[model samples]
Target: MSEARAARPWLALLAGAGYGLFYLYAIGDVTLYGPPHWGAYLTEVSLERIFTARSTLMFEAIAVIELGWVVWLFSPLNLFLALILAGLLAANMHGVLYIRAHPKQCQVGGNKAFIGALPALFAGGACCAPSLILLLGIPGLGAFGALFGWLLPISIVVLGINRIWQHGHGAPSMLEYARQRFGLNNPSTA
Candidate 1:
């Protein structure tokens, strides 16, 4: 690998880490990982949603399917929703990380920003939708919470779209470049 190529992933890492720490201290304070009640990290199904569930056999089935889809398509989460979202995010991150670490793979198609946004929007930000944020004495964090809530999720979307555009334009992602430089290309060997 060339010198510049070697340095690129570190740059990504540095930027990612810096942003992570900033988000961690700024908005992540009230989150589960921070000082708030550990339970704050968790999301539970709303009683209202359960009660409002559609009736009728077919409609119920459709509603179930729709509910599942809506949960994944959106960033909101409860206990079940958290599990489902975590599973999907884990799978996606696994793929993205594999592509980054593997030598053979050359495309970084997944948006890692989602990894950050999930925690921010769901556990750390406005969408926490629970008393966790309220428990924290710092009302100033409300602004941080709101900002990161929207910013992180929106960044996830923008980054995803940007990745697609970059790939479409034949640009190599940092992961792809790093894979070609340092990672094994073969899956079997992995």
Candidate 2:
């Protein structure tokens, strides 16, 4: 496999861990905070509106999805699946990074796999933070949300970009290097 392809599993694991940590931190922050001061910000918006049963359900869904993602990413039996997941994640990372670097690239599916995963990422964040903030009346949940929701995604995207840069900067190309070193084919093409 190409070097990039060979490294897919590790990359996937790293990406999964990154996202997992982000979620964990966000969840922890909300659980600790209590609830958001929406009333302080808006006269019309009540805590009940923010923390509806539907919102709680949404949070549960996010928790399930994130937990599933973490399990799949770390499961040894799911290496191939992890690789596939990594590819999608890499695409999303690329998309986020691209959008950051070039604001004009935010169109849906503009980055294909990357953009495809945006909804999941956003949903994950929303489910984790907004729901908690609504229900608990937390103080820093918004800040936490902004940090993980925005910075973490951007960081992951930058990580992917850096990997691409490092892989492409040398002579033989990452694929050739991986093929020679690990007998791995270029799965990116596959």
Candidate 3:
């Protein structure tokens, strides 16, 4: 592969990492305290709590790392979940980038990749819903708790299904399907 082609995968990986970090921050696993102070670091790990679940799929943080002004509550299970979601997102992003680079050849619009991205974004929201629901004073606490707990898992399943579906359909097939669904006039068929 050429230099540009080689860089695309790396770029996608970076995007995934950025999103994973954002998810961690949103869920209160990672936090910022103040300006960075070089050479300041402290960490604590509780092996006993490594596999504990705080709520539904949410796991307890078995480790804590304090680096200068940043604090991270590390949970292996949660990190694994984040990585899975991020990897799917990165794969979709790579598809989007590839489509953008060779639009004429791909034929399919980049919107499908954008649609694939929605699940991960929505999954991130699931992480923050609990705090938001409490602050908003929602009356149906129990029902909301049950619903919110499953949102992340549901999003993961959706993303997995989308990945399989996208892989099974080639660009031309997807393009034709999009045209049919949206009533776009395909030159060949016209």
Best by lDDT: 3
| Best model per TM-score | 3
Which pairs in model 3 have colliding backbones? none
Residue-level lDDT tens digits of model 3 in 58-91: 7888657777888788889889988977776566
Model 1 regions lying over 4 Å from their true place: 1-7, 28-148, 188-190
Q: TM-score of every model?
A: 0.36, 0.29, 0.68
* lDDT score for candidate 1 against the true structure: 0.37
Model 1 Cα displacement at 107 (Å)? 17
Query: Is 2 or 3 the stronger prediction by TM-score?
Result: 3
Rank list by lDDT: 3, 2, 1
Q: Write the per-residue lDDT of candidate 1 for residues 8-67, one digit (tens) a residue.
A: 455545545444433323322212222222111223355444434221100111121122
